[model samples]
Target: MKPVSLLLAVALGTATVVSAGPAVIECWFVEDAGGGRLSKKPSALLLRQSSESPPPRPDLDPERYLKVHDPAGTLLAAFRRYPRDAPAPRCEMSHYVPLPASAIWVSGLTPEQSCPRALDGRWLMVSMSSPVLSLSSLLRPQSEPQPEPALITVATAVLTVLTHTPTPRIRIGQDALLDLSFAYTPPTPKAATSLAPGPPPFGLEWRRQHLGKGHLMLAATPGLSGPMPAAREGAVAFAGWDDDEPLGPWTGNGTFWLPAVQPFQEGTYLATVHLPYLQGQTTLELAVQKPPKVTLTPAPLIWAAPGEAPPELLCLVSHFYPSEGLEVEWELWGGPEGRFQKAEGQRWLSALSHHSDGSVSLSAHLQPPPVTTGQHGARYACRVHHPSLPALGRSAEVTLQVAGLSGPSLEDGVGLFLSAFLLLGLINMLGWAAAYLATSEDSVEKVRHSTFLYFSLLILSPLPNSSPEGGCWLGGQNPDLEFTQTCIKSCHLKHAT
Candidate 1:
């Protein structure tokens, strides 16, 4: 008899001719017989069905095909018979001894016959409903094989293989995408051309809707351009197929795309996909951009009360991105000219921060100039430089004013006292002049001494540059012709007397 091609069951009593030429089903069992060495006994089997026309006969007798082999080149079973047109009979086998062997059935078989055989135990059973084949096995007590339906119906059970490697961290405000590549292998025979390594067209949305859940949120397109497919819920946009179309299990290189990841949504995410023969999962720890916030403040001098030591000013940088790149500076403005520097105080210091939250701060003591009078208020400032911020950087400034006892300062007070004394002397001299005008001309000589003395005091309002003793010289040089000569002559005569 020639090798036969078995037609898989499409429905209860229907047959399916593979799109490819024909179909074949195979089953095998193996065992290790002993010591480090094992039994070279026969274990594998093969079944094939024929599509050629049958010869004229009383009853239709389909040709049969079967082959069996082992490492020792042994044949366990070989036979030929006509395929049963009606529903294949149902048979059951159980309580068989466990052994180091394996049984595999492949080709266009129904779901009932496509189940995986137990890999570890003892007992073995097989139920053959079609002229094709069936098989089973056993292992240790660790795990038990679940019971499958006794009928060999349609093909089911596919394997899913997902491939994903860790990608670079995603930056904030930038577009990001998560693509999960996938493939599926149907439970068909290895020889079936349709059983290639590829994913089916199952709606990615369907998979997500059923198995998808987490804190991860999906956003609409971020307007990014690249060779990667546009992200969609049901399937990969670049898959070259519609979202809802169902593809064969063999063409398994399908990719499912998640929604775009937002900048604020940063965390580890777990993604899992379940397919017929296999299931796969991967963990993605997402990174995001967080700009730093800068603050300028003064540390407590001593709680609510002032301490012996002056207060320290601080420049605090918080919530920064790329934590390693944080930088801070302190400056003082207001002195001889409008300039600033970091050396005005006792110390220009920055405290190191080891926090994972990406926040850092700088601190230093505040020191005001010693000559605080008459000078304008001193200015304190802080500057923060970070890549996340502008090139000019961010900064803050403050002006501190120190007031003296005599108004704003002591210099103003001395000038005011001098102006008042000058006014009083001028009034006295004018009174004396008026009194002398009422008296006789000859009497003027007697009061001349008093008049000159008052006039001299008023002229002395502006201090002499050379010496305090030169004050009298200033009095004699007055621009009034009457007083310039009279006052000078009287002082000379009085000193002579």
Candidate 2:
């Protein structure tokens, strides 16, 4: 006999143990030749051997064996026969248990072969209807040994997360794209593959969406780009995977997107994303805004109607939200040429326009100069414009009055008073002439007196300067001629008296 065993099963040589634990199916059985030629006949015959050991057979298939099922729950399969050279059996199918030390086969030939097995479990010896392992008669472990399907190649149940790290927070008006992935082990997953129970990177719309949604819109292509819209009210909902209706006990998580906007304002904002399979969420931040603008109007003291007198002007002012700096100034045009005049009792020539509504405002008055008297239809007005740039402000106008009063002439008073002076001088001249005529006893005395008065009288009106020889004189010489004539006339009058 020789050491015979299955093709891949373990084998034993001469002097191996007589009793051993359940053996792997052996293809070759070692048996004594008994001086007979080999027999090769394929026949259907079933046999069971309740022996302590398996008899060796060279005719069996390597590593192939049959199982025997009993009405009870016991299971049995073939094992390698020991002794390196055990006697072979001639039957096709035989059930056996090796016990009683080396005693295995207990056909009716040897009741001494019946025995018990090692490992303490009872096995029935019977011919099987089907192959147990390669065939379908036997059932393997059913329920998973752990939560997920895992191989026991390694001793420990180590699980490395073989998916993308959780997603990050997304911002408003921003088309930032993110790729989710991971490297794990039992061995790391291959590239671009995801777990069957959860989403691939592109599952949730809130994390990503259709082209231009109410908020955080999608791109023309798969990722964010191409005319995307900003998020509204800054909100969004996150969930892993599609088609997760009512999300059963399967797997994953739900997340929320807090508000996010672009062109950030000067404040704080928040955001969230859901990992359905992981049963959790992620967060992010953002800020948003725009700038401010401003404007003006004018009112001057006086504004003339198209034809009426110019009315004084009035004014007002205001500003816009987030107002910047204020620029202000004024100008006067298309009006009477007059110096600016203040009212008798006012400090500021202009009044400020008042808006209780909190606006910027201001105004002034122009005192028109006197217009020509009796001059009709004099046209005059003043236009005070503000830096109301881009447009001309309202104007203040003034109308000149032409009607006036008439008074006494210059000569009326001057002529009356001048004539009175001439009359008084003439009366004095006559009085002196008459007194001379009345008092004169001698001609010489009367002439002297008359000449003096006549010369004095002539001096009343402007006359040429007098001299003695060829020109006139102040003394009683030629001056005596008029004086003598006057005396003779006056003397005759006195004689008549």
Candidate 3:
């Protein structure tokens, strides 16, 4: 059987460059030889420059020509050679082949330009053809004619660039979704050309090889986690790709579930995507936040004397993340009508203190207005607001009571009664002394004087409202002062008779 030759020519170009950094170039190859017996002949070549004289073609020797490395197993696996007997055998291979600096020096390429730029129009040509027949040709008769080896070129491919756009800020423990977009110029006739005629170069196998290298990856500097392959389960999973046109812009949307981020995990991370011609990466910042613990001072209840100044209400917010955006609101409930309203008073906030664990604490003070009798049983509430808290925030409530407002209690009434009884007894003793002095002269005059003094004392002395008339008398009329009434009644009756 006659052996068929398959030639593939690929042109590589630099795609995405990071902050004036050097650009990287990648190449992939796919070949199909119509199920012909595979050959072990030198099958690949890399031409670095265009010379007036024909450039030398070297084999795809990893030690000399191309240093082939595929950290991602998908690349080499998609391009492995198949058995000769396999129907419609196809092979694919992709690699990151860096041109040696010595090669660039020998080519006299300027250092200012990247390797891909220096070898912009060069070609990576691969040939898959059976070996020449040496022993079989010798056995044939000298008269019989031998077919000449044909040099056929299959298809030509122009280089394409891949790029990733910058991602937005992500919150801790949030499900982050990244939209990855890539753009590349279409293949131009002048960019690449075929040397002969054969089969098409890029087909299903070529598409597989292209996709094998197009994987999104995430990594952190402080080692948040192991290298996370975006396509893996429980990590970043791509929904799908939008590539309507082969030569136009394309996009891949992926969802990454971030682990619960701690305070130490707050920082910038790198998201990268590898493609055939570019390694694109962008930075993603992770924000961490902790909810605040709220407490109000002078809690439960506050006692305000009638003529004294109102006490200060304090609200303490502690153990919160981010020192800013904290708010404290004061509310008052219970007036004559028992209506709830925002408390307007002198309000001030203390300077924020930052902790080593990245938490913040602060105190807010509210000086209430002068307390009044109407404000008794009023409740003061301190409500705290923060980004990490709920919309209504956390709150603490306290009740205010105005002293000297309610009339004297049972204890005060009892004390007043005892004091009044002692005063009345002292007045009676003085009256008896005066009567005794008068009685030294006449008994009738002394009795009359004593009755008059007792009546006078009763009229002049202030007393509690223990009787039906709301005042105590020198008779047994008030039930609360029965003992005093009984002792004074006999004296009162003698004086009346």
Q: Flag the better candidate by TM-score, 2 or 3.
A: 3
lDDT of 2: 0.29
Per-residue alpha-carbon lDDT of candidate 1 for residues 1-497, written as tens digits (9 for 90 to 100): 11131112122112322122212333222335567654322121122223542122222111111121111110111112224353332333222342211212111122233434522233232222232322111111212212222111111113222223223355444544554443333333442222433333232211222123443222111121223223343333333222211233232223334344344344554443333222333444456555666666652111111122224555566655655565666666764445765635554555555444443444433443343433345566767777667787887666544433224347678888899889888776664553444343566665565455545544554334333343235434446766555644544344334
Candidate 2, residues 318-407: lDDT per residue as tens digits? 321112232223333222433443222111333334333223344333333333343233333333333322354343333333333224
Q: How accurate locally, in lDDT, is each candidate? A: 0.37, 0.29, 0.44
For residues 1-497, what per-residue lDDT tens digits would candidate 3 score against the true structure?
A: 11121111111111111112211112235434468644333333222222232222333333222322221111122222222343321212322332422211112222234543422432332221111100000000112212222221222222211112122344434444433322222223221112232211110000001212432233211101233223322343343343333332233333334444445444444433332222333334445677788788787768888756678999888888766678889999886555988897899999988887667799989998887788888888989887777899898888888986656769899999999999889887876664454335466566556556655765675334445433434444554444553444544444434
Q: Considering every candidate listed, which one attains the maximal TM-score?
A: 3
lDDT of 2 at 467: 31
Regions of model 1 farther than 4 Å from truth: 1-168, 183-264, 293-312, 316-497
Candidate 2, superposed: residue stretches over 4 Å from native: 1-356, 373-388, 391-497
- Clashes in model 3: which pairs? 79-92
List the candidates ranked by TM-score, beginning with the highest. 3, 1, 2
Query: What are the models' TM-scores?
Result: 0.27, 0.17, 0.35
Clash count per candidate:
32, 54, 1
